[model samples]
Target chain A: MHLSPMPSAIVATELSKTYDVKVRDPGIKGALAALARPRYRQVRAVDNVSFSIERGDAVAFLGPNGAGKTTTLKMLTGLLFPTAGKAQVAGYDPWSGGNPFRQRIAFVLGNKQQLLWDLPPEETFRLNRAIYGVSLADYTTRRAELVELLLLGDLIDKPVRQLSLGERMKCELAAALLHQPEVLFLDEPTLGLDLEAQQTIRTFLGEYRRRHGATILLTSHYMADVTALASRVLIINRGRLLYDGELSELVARIAPIKRIELVLSETVSRARLEEYGTVAHYAPPRATLEVPRETATAASTRLLTDLDVADLSIQDPPIEEVIRIAFGETEQDAEEDTVRTDVQRAPP
Target chain B: MTRFTRAMIVLRAFWQLNWLEELQYRGNFVASLLGTIFWLVMAMLTVSLFFRHTPQLGGWGYWDVVVLLGIFNALAGVVETVLRPGIGHLPTDVRSGALDLVLVRPVDAQFYVSFRRLDVWRLADVMLGLAVSGYAFVQTGRAISAWELLAFAVTFAVAIAVVYAIWVTLMSLAFWFVAVENMAALFDAVFEAARYPVSAYPGALRFLFVYLIPIAWTTTIPASALTGRLNPALATWAAAVGVAALGASRVLWRVALKRYTSAGG
Candidate 1:
């Protein structure tokens, strides 16, 4: 059997996932009833998410919790079978691609760990090297490069459990990259990390992409991660893809207004602050105003001259807020057409 | 290279890592040895207690029953050393979504999960069990021939295959029933009956052990080979049983894996 080749690094068509979550009423009575006859509720975790990512591009998957970001990544990595639709990574059907397909891709989940807990991270690296069939010479060279880039001196030798959270995460990234996969699927790679640690990861990822030219599809809750590493963004909510475009375009479309902060030497009236622009917040010595993006610079300049402002700062709305607006507005427009069948169930 | 060779490469790497990790817990080796000795002595004492009342059990002499017990212990050692720490962790992995890591690897997921871990210290149980079998064979005053020794070797391997198949079947149930976290416990409870010859049990229990659970084939046939009780036809049947058991369990494992939803993303 022969087939046409896919040129894109990753392509997904009408990809979807639905989970048959077991449902039971609360309390002891429901428990007994469930044991006698089980009930199942279907939840559509990912709905018709279709997008193609070109090689050598860093794209961020932005969404709130349970917005199908992780689910999409799982399907792309061939971890979860899609309920409907198809996906291809590195020109092969990811679900049925077998070992050759697996060899060409890597996936990293920040919440879960793949390293052996009792052994050092170095041991896991060796295990992966052997499993992936990397030659000993290439393994040594790659190991040294990753260790230096991730700043993982002596950390790989220590037991995984003994390392700090940040240190362990670095080791995890190194392990996942040992084979230098052509495609990367990262879910919340910097979740729960400190500012410094997050920054380190962001920088390393950017450098790795530049050097390897691998296709990267990353999902992160931290806006800093997206702003630093991704040039494009895809927003999903309620199991649907709402927006997919340039990161800058998404920010411009969702949030046309920029935020300007003012610190007055003395108290200021709410009405006076309103004269400059739309007052977002008003207090004794601090106030914030929302101005049109085009007039942000002029407005901030005028605010400093018009008021007894000790300091003033102009900044665009946070990416989190922009994506939140995108989710809320798009959700309302599509809400009438979609049916809700999902109910919350504790993970098994 | 063939898939088998790739699997071997993965296994060697994993075993090396397991050895290194196990070295750190040397204390567990001592504790495990003590535990094995305690259980062995208790089993021997129980056998002695039964022999006091009767000269033979189920028409077999006392030393023959001891030979069966030794075979049973050796099979249990295989479970503890490999299957217990390896496939036994399947339920937990399924519940926690750790199986995702195993599935993403290029190697076969079933092979990776089945032989991922080894309890090195528990291997002593296997040697000790073989030692007991040899000692009891000597006491039985049986003149062993080359044919009997070869039969014993083949049947012993068959015994291990049957036991491994049993474990895979039990553990595969985890994918269907994620909440049943202690499926291995059920195996342990039933495996306790394999300590004695199936003939020593009543008709119903003997049938259950022989056909349904197949614990009888795991120990009895191998021990019978050494004790001069196994016929060539019966040994051939045991090999067939082993092959069939492995084939059935493999099919079950494939079906169960389809049901894996990969919990917690």
Candidate 2:
């Protein structure tokens, strides 16, 4: 199979957002005081964050709560303007309300949807067809295709309020893509979905990207979503871009160690496992060892030969662990490695 | 096809869907019909009560005022059924950031926002109001002339335009004061005065309604045409007012859209 060249789909420079939140204290006294003199506070939701996406690329924006991922998505989708920065989606200034630009993009928020609550998804589809001015032939064909792809058979006729969460999400996706937008911004699209539902949505997203060659920027707390769909990961923390690169590079940058798990034939002492590497977990008949990348093979070989190893396997540390360490949980481990290396290299 | 025909298609789609959706809540039909009747009866009683002490109010008799009240109810129906349900969603949309979906659509955002939804059951008020106005015309024993009918048509259209302008102006403020969640209520508070004819109002209130806030234009000018009391020259002025109202609302909508930094981001 041949690979296609990447094309630029979205760009942003120094994107920033600040909200003027009204501040007031509690109680009747505070209310009276506020009535006399109101106080205002400016909260910086997204501060000078920037990134770009290429066509046909599925990028996952991972961040903790209040990390500005949703804010950045909103600005990129033309839902909100930056407090002070430049941003563009499909060569149109998002804040300008340009028709051509609007026609080229779509947004789906997990918590918020555009479907009319009292009406069936089909009615919304019809309304969208007219609102977007899509041709009847194109609308019918696209609706049929999306229905088949998303498996929205009986769900489309039911009122949106009557659909289940996962079912509604499927309809939301179908409605969003009915116009065939070139750029898709999905915020926590798999949120509130069960495991099977999550897999279904991920599969649909993969197929959608393959078929349309559309640029997708998705944010989700589910790392499985990231690992499955995103070739590239953009990690953000405290409203800053901590890392931006391929998923492998992020894992390598943050976690250079491989974990080796062993199922011992007999109960192995913790000291024996510690001699080979740090014993992350020790239990009867099972032990987990963390070894440096260079010494992974050596440590695994020793565990098999020197210990009562029943079954042994080597794998990268869990991505969740890597993410936690990147957020400063493993600083002591890094410090210990520094001391141990200094001691080893002293006079050997 | 003309722009009007295209707009009609859009409106027809909304109307059909609105009907189907509203049909689910069949109880609301009786509730709304009763609510309209109650308000109509209250308005007639107010006219009757006023006429008990005097035969004419500011030179117009009881039937003329009732005719004006009927026009007021019809315009109110237009507002509650269409404008309020439609444009009233603007403030919440602004607050929750749902307006993003609307702004990105290919159609004109203002036009779509204003006419996208309909409360079909409230349209009963429109028919009932026209019925009351016809009854009052009979009581007045005035032969309806062709010119009066034509003038009434023009002015009633103008009334709709004016009411639409009021809504646009009110909803436009949502952009500036994003926290003002009850902006539609402000329109409702002022629109209450339009239930009475402009002449029944005292000097200060009349002046305020006609000139300052222009709520009186919603019903008084139209009822004037229907009562054969409209000056031919003022009909031209009313048409000009209708054009200016639409133009001003459009300009205000543009300005409001500019200030919308959106809600979430």
Strongest candidate by DockQ: 1
Clash counts per candidate, in order, are: 0, 0
Q: Show pairs that collide, candidate 1.
A: none
Docking class of 2: acceptable
Score chain B of each candidate by TM-score: 0.98, 0.95
Model 2 per-residue lDDT tens digits across residues A250-302: 76666678889889898778886789988888886888888898999988887
- CAPRI accuracy category, model 1: medium
Model 1 chain B weakest 10-residue run by lDDT: B176-185
Cα error, residue A197 of model 2, in Å, equals 1.3
Compose the digit string of candidate 1's lDDT tens values, residues A1-348: 544364889999999998877788899999998888878777889999999988889999987788889999989988889999998898889889999999999999898899999989999999999889999999999999899888899999899999888888899999999999999988888988887778888899999999999899999766668889998988887688988889788766666777888889977899988887888878768888888888999888887777788988887665545766655555454465344463443345
- B1-265: candidate 2 lDDT, tens digit per residue: 4556656767777877888899899999999899889989987997899899999987788999889888888988899899988987888888888887777666677878998888888899999998899899899989988998999989999999988998888888889887654767777888888877788789999989877787777788888887777999989988888889989999999888877877655
Which candidate gets the maximum TM-score versus the true structure? 1
* Cα lDDT computed for each candidate against the true fold: 0.87, 0.83
Over the true interface, candidate 2 deviates by an RMSD, in Å, of 2.0
